[model samples]
Target: MFEFFPGDHVRSSSVNLALMAGGSLADIGRWLGPLRDTPEAGLDAWAAAWAGMAHQQEALAAGDVRAGYLAAAGRRYLRASVYHATAQRQIPPGPTKSESYAASLQAFGNAMDCGALPLVRVHVDSPDGTLPGYLIAPDAADPRPVVIVYGGLDLTKEMLYATVGAAFARRGITCLVIDTPGTGELIRLRGVPSRPDYEVPTAAIIDHLQARHDVDARHVAVLGVSFGGYYAARSAAFEPRVSACVSWAGSWDCGALWRRRWDEAEAEPTSWFLPWVTGTGTIEEALERLELWTLADVWPRVTQPLLIVHGENDREIPVADARRAFEAAGSADKRLHVFAAAGGGAEHIQSDDPAPALDLIAEWLSLRMPVLPEPPVPALA
Candidate 1:
């Protein structure tokens, strides 16, 4: 990954994430330029810098809207949304984080409206509550294969949509980017904690999708990124509705990973991140809760077609997790692809360079899911 913050791995990863979410190099330079030498600058300073840029983009979007340049306005709003979301990632859970999250959602909605994007805000009824998500479907009227994407750790559905969801849509597949429990809106706004039995929510999401006319219910797939790799695999193991599963940077034992991090005194982007997402008061509590998050038993139950993609130089989760998942999976048809450090996507989830990984995933899904053919044009022109 590009180290915009030099020695700061946390901030550097954040920069890579922003870039993956459509942030420009010039804008990133402008935002982090002043803080380059300020070693003492903390999370507040980082949040402020990104928030300032977000406000600027929001203002530009408003001006574009006033001039009736909807497309231009939409582009600005999208950037603004990304900036706001990025800003909130640095802050601890509180009123400030809530405000920033709300702003990001609003900006993203405006972007969709102004751009006339083929996306819809969806709410799937789950055992916990109504799970919030954004669905992007192809322009075609025919039913298409659908992939339910769940983000990990601090990632939101909006960020996933901007990075991964749209790519699937372009390939004629319907994509549902969900803010699953323990991540994004659920944990941030609703205080819904992460759960080990992800299949419950996954089933609910599939139930909702099956009701949609635009979706091919039989071809439903589940994909999870970063820490979400466990969620996707676990869901696929139990949920028979899921036709295929993709673990983007698979996690074999997240609890073990957290314990290792704790032992090593690893540096985290924010102190509150894990605790907040896990719905715990401290790191120790979060680690204890995460003990049930392992896929040691879950992997053996996944009989569906499975794809495990891991970065050879992934700084967060070791590539060994991917191998473990691949070896343990009960699926007769399972493949593991590891991007080497020499290549671009050697970092977590291919954040260093996401295009190739995204392409590989799309192609893999296309072969498995098989997108429906579009309706023929009428003879009378």
Candidate 2:
């Protein structure tokens, strides 16, 4: 709700989100240099600025790849993907939205293809069709623990990897970044709606992981962001195979939040996003569908180790939700960490800078995951 652009909360938040999703300060400066001072910036203006920057990056990325500059190409492609995603979020579900989303996915694919890391595209069969996923291994030769990461609400799978999945991989953890039902390609392309029973998809993901020889199924974990916090908690509560769980923002009772937001009547972009994700035609219908999103009944069922991380200044989901979820969980090994402004993680998911939060999550998961064998010491002969 805080506005960096005087009266434009949406534009301001979009800029912050773009940076959080891996946009560079230089890119932001170039994109917003002209429009930041202009009054009454509309959505079209917002989309156009980001889209123009994204196209330029994409072109440079292609040229870099052709010139055998793989690393440079990867970085440019990643930036372009984030910019396209930012532009797509500003627009609604229409041709322009679809076009930007497609461009974002394509750029992400190009980034992966540049071989910056060993990221492979995976598709899991679901009732709706195939769910797109990216499988990144910490080491191809070793069997490592995997974390299935998904985004909340409007987040795309590319943004999830840009923010968290890459960090996990760097810390010796395998990551499966998926566009689950009701999100990303599933919603924008296949028309899948939000399901309270996230374990259904979680089960499919576990099955996919188990079938792979590189994964240590015994230590598999699920982590979710924003509204996805609710999905991860629900899956951990019901799915016996999930060894651990993390609620990035701790969505204990999303239905209650919906009710409150509806009554408040500000009608942010989410007022449209919620219904679209839930496959409802209106907010009233979406709220009715969201009745199943509460975690009151599910908390007692979570027997695995649980981690709840919340921001002290989180305006969307209050820090109290983390406390409530932690208290209700049956996990004896549960822990609650509230990052305050002093620690640089007080913002939601540590958007101002994700390093601290990513480091915390990676360290936490490292301790719980199956240990890998250490390298042999070289002989001094």
Candidate 3:
């Protein structure tokens, strides 16, 4: 991975995420240049720099909208949203974090409106609560296979859309980027914490998708990125409706992973992330709660077609997890693809170079699911 901050893993990861979301390198360089002398622990400085950039982009977007340059406005708003989300990621859980997150969501929504993107905000009723998501559907009206995408520890549905959902839609696949329990809107806004039984929420999301006229429910797939890899695997293990499953840098046992981290005395870059996401007050409590999140017993139950993608140099989840997942999965049609560090995409979720990973996933899906036909070109006005 290219480190924007030499020794600051947290800030460097944020940089990769920003780029993955289509942020401009020039603009990011300008925003972060002055903070070069700042220490790795200078979270406030990092947040301030990103927040300032977000404000500027928001202002530019406003001007573009007023000038009737809708496309330009959309582009600006998307940049602003990425900036706000980056700032939000650096802050601790508090009013400031809340404000930054809300700004990100607002900017993302504005981008959708200005661009007239083929996406819709959806809310599904789950036993836990309301699951908020964005559905990016292809232009064609025909029933299409849909993939439900869940993000990791700190990712929002909007970020998923910006990073991967739109690409899936362009491949003629309906992409539903959701905020399941424990992440995104549910965790940040509604105080929902991550649960061990992810299949419950997965079932709810599938139920909602099955009711949609534009979706081919029989061909639904579940994909999880980062920590969400656990969610995807767990869901497919129990949810019979899920025809396929993909785990992008997921884990075999998150609890054991945390324990290893603790034993190795390696602190998580974001100190507050685990406790907050797990709804625990301390690291010990969080570890105890995560014990039930393992897929050891469940992997054998995942009979659907499975694809596990991992980065050989992923600093977060170990590549061995992917291998173990593949070996244990009950699916007769299962494959594991590992990107070598030399080939790029060896970082977590292939953030270093996501193109190859993304292309592979799109092609893999095309082989197993029914892709919608390309929409006819419209007559010139």
Candidate 4:
């Protein structure tokens, strides 16, 4: 949509494709690039978009579709970069709403509790790490089918605690929210970079989920939110243990993400993107760093019950990327939902409206996986 947006223009810095010998392209193909005209302008768009996100967020209560608002968010500031040579303009983040973020999630969860959803926090360990995660479970059980939820690039496991936890808790199903690579405190404290090979870490999560005897091994499922949509789906494809998978706001590759940032900031050949280029690519020859994580490599292998949900208006990741992922999945049971409201569905998850989407997910999980009731709490050990 940025292509069609009035003020938006694709920044040349988005795609610095070097041609190869003969007519053949390099294995790392040069496709589409970023959208920002320049970092200064991107800042303006960011400010405008951020200013109105809260209103659309409120729209969820009123049953907005979500895709439109999401698109507006994208079209508004599709250019924003951490690159810092000399920003043309900087959109100062308004009153830190980390509190608002938490409150909104909590309020949603509380509403669920009022209706009898059971949510609990548990300690989970990933091979070399341990983290806190929320568990949403049905009441009463001999065994339970559990779903592990992984969220997108910008979200923390804490951010999902309310969304995923509350969503599943209401369904009487166990939903676990974990901080994987490139996300939240995990990335902050642990120098773990996001890997194209997502299963490496998720395998560790599965180990933790299965350790609980109350969890039904046959029915364990995995879900990814936003960028996590790719990771969770990829993991489900390789891990024989996963019975079903859901990609909520998915993308086909990480390459697109970085490229989008470049365009949003209009960083091509511009000093503003030096920091991002340095962090993700090869300014310093960092040993373990890689820029683009493509889904073309992982999609061919996925074979599980799958569901993909995306807002047509997503500005951050073009909806086309999500469509590519959905098309690539080999799963015979795959499903795709492109949300299109007046403002847009779940605007890249800061959706003006999220309940309908969440409700849809919960419903699908219920229909696809048989619910296992929570087992009685063991008498104090």
Candidate 5:
């Protein structure tokens, strides 16, 4: 993340993701330097800078493609996609927002052409229309244990993959990264808002996996990042098909957070972000509706092996909230790992440094959903 400007957590976090997705720091510096102390250092300003970087990368990618440097082009295209996605994160609904999103998806597709991974676009049948997702598999022929991943309020399927999908794939785990209702393309194009009953989409994903020959239907798990922790936990409670559940920062009650005074609420910008996610006309109405997004009633039903990974210093959701979740969970085999200062992932979703937390998650999943070894070849004799 670039430190050119002072105290814009949102922009800094977005840049963190961009860098994690293989963006160049020097290029980021180049874009960020001009915005220093400028009056236009807010949303439009950051968006313009990011879009600038994206356009530059895309042009370079195009040149590389023309010069038969497909591998290099692929790398640049992926970087461009990350830049575009970051650019559109906070922009209000408009042509610019739509264009940036389209650019991100297009660049991602272009990158896939050069052997990023075997990606299969899936449309899971859901009550709330089809939930679009990408299944990144290690191999089409091998039936691998799959991890279904979804992100929080602002995260998209592409971001989730860039964050951890590649790591899972490298460890031989197939990943189904979905936009889900109220997130990513679902929100942007379909106008879908978040719902507390995440079991709906969870079941749909399970059904889709069941129908697929490349997935190990019996060993599926669900992972939710940031605000998605609540969603994943809810899904695990109701959808018994989820063999294991990882809440990447547990959220006990989103409603409780909203009811608190702004000074006390850990989830900042709730007044702003909630309305957008709930499709409420006002923050008050959104706060009222968010009462439905709590896990107090759901955690007791979660009997699956649960892994709660929380940043000890998470600013958005308190570590105490994570403890509440862990205590309420009925699962006998559950762990609440509170990453402290000594560890690298002690921040919100470990967005700044995800390796330690991701390592633990991957290792945990490997134990529960061990990969199948390749079949021995027949002797030539």
Candidate 6:
């Protein structure tokens, strides 16, 4: 679906390895050394750099390494910068529960460089629906910050780790990426709709995260990506458990992405709108249903420090969304980092050259809320 050119796959493969294994991250990046010198790699790097996007629940509960890397080998057409320091999030045990279905998406993701964080999928009871989610944290970390990641529209939690999930892991935050109501298998296969109270299901995520001894009750955050970005911002507004919030290439509004991706103007899938989100409605009806989840009504609730990153030339969720979010976000520390414009910092997800975008995200989080290791003081001359 990314429809990337030749060398993009190679860089993606290496990055996948690095997202899952953070400290030795360069080991995976070393493969792209050849492309490092080429100009096309810069363009490829933008897409490849954000190859880590997605809300992975234990990468869906995640995907492969060797074969994917071998596949990306020797493609020298396109490459991009290797920036951003994201580590793999591991789960420690206390009250945390664990399980794995044969559904670990490694094979599907191996080729995609979508590193999954792995987790036991559990069904939580809610008034509107049964929220299904992955608890992606280790049970034994002395202390851990908990995160609940929401998936983008149509994409599954199993496959979105390369960017979103990997970003949080680098922060050493435990994450729970869920299928939620309107995204992924839940809506495509199951009959769920995007609810206005997205925080309702998210409460379950907080419950599961807090139940674990590995989680720090005081430091919970929500990082919503793509479609989930809007919902997460709204959720942090009411859910005190969410100590901080971020929406990457987030949606200030919804339904618009669906229209661009699925409206008659665009190529429609075999199933126009899945039963869960539309539930036997016409496209117009589907649009109406999703309206229930739009951020137009909910943005006011979000009060936490908000960070929104959007591509200046973004065709899907216009940069206007970021502008609106920056204005509407009640957080005094709110920020908007617009990618240059595909050539430099402004590509979608910084897809043309991710170095600037990736670094900006790391730096922003470091300032607002992060648990950093003490830096060694320079020796006195």
- Between candidates 1 and 2, name the one with more favorable TM-score: 1
Tell me each candidate's TM-score: 0.95, 0.93, 0.95, 0.63, 0.92, 0.62
lDDT of 3 by residue, 77-143 (tens): 8889989998988688998799889999899889988974567879999998999998888777687
TM-score: model 2 vs. ground truth = 0.93
lDDT of 6 by residue, 230-284 (tens): 7778788878778778887857667665655565454242244433345645666
lDDT of each: 0.87, 0.83, 0.86, 0.55, 0.83, 0.53
Q: Clashes in model 1: which pairs?
A: none
lDDT: which candidate is best? 1
Regions more than 4 Å wrong, model 2: 1-4, 373-381
Better of 3 and 4 by TM-score: 3
Worst 10 residues of 1 by lDDT: 265-274
Ranking, TM-score, top scorer first: 1, 3, 2, 5, 4, 6
Clashes of 5: 0
Model 1 Cα lDDT, one tens digit per residue, 1-381: 689989888888888898888888888898888899898998778888888888889899899999999999988888888988998887887877888899999999999889645688899999989999988887777888899998888889988887874688778888999888888888888899888899999999999988887688778999999988888999999999899999999889999988888788783545567788788899888888989889998899999999999999998999988898899999999999999989779999999999999999988988888886646689996
Local accuracy of candidate 5 as per-residue lDDT tens digits, 69-176: 988898888888889998888787778888899989998989888765468888888888888889888753678889999799888898787778566777778989
Model 2 lDDT per residue over 237-351, tens place:
8889999998888877888888887788745655687788889998889998998899988998998888888888886788998889889899999898898887667867767
The segments of candidate 5 whose C-alpha lies over 4 angstroms from its true place after superposition are 1-4, 261-272, 373-381
lDDT of 4: 0.55
Cα TM-score of candidate 3: 0.95
Global CA lDDT computed for model 1 = 0.87
The better-scoring model by lDDT among 3 and 5 is 3
In candidate 4, position 83 carries an lDDT of 12
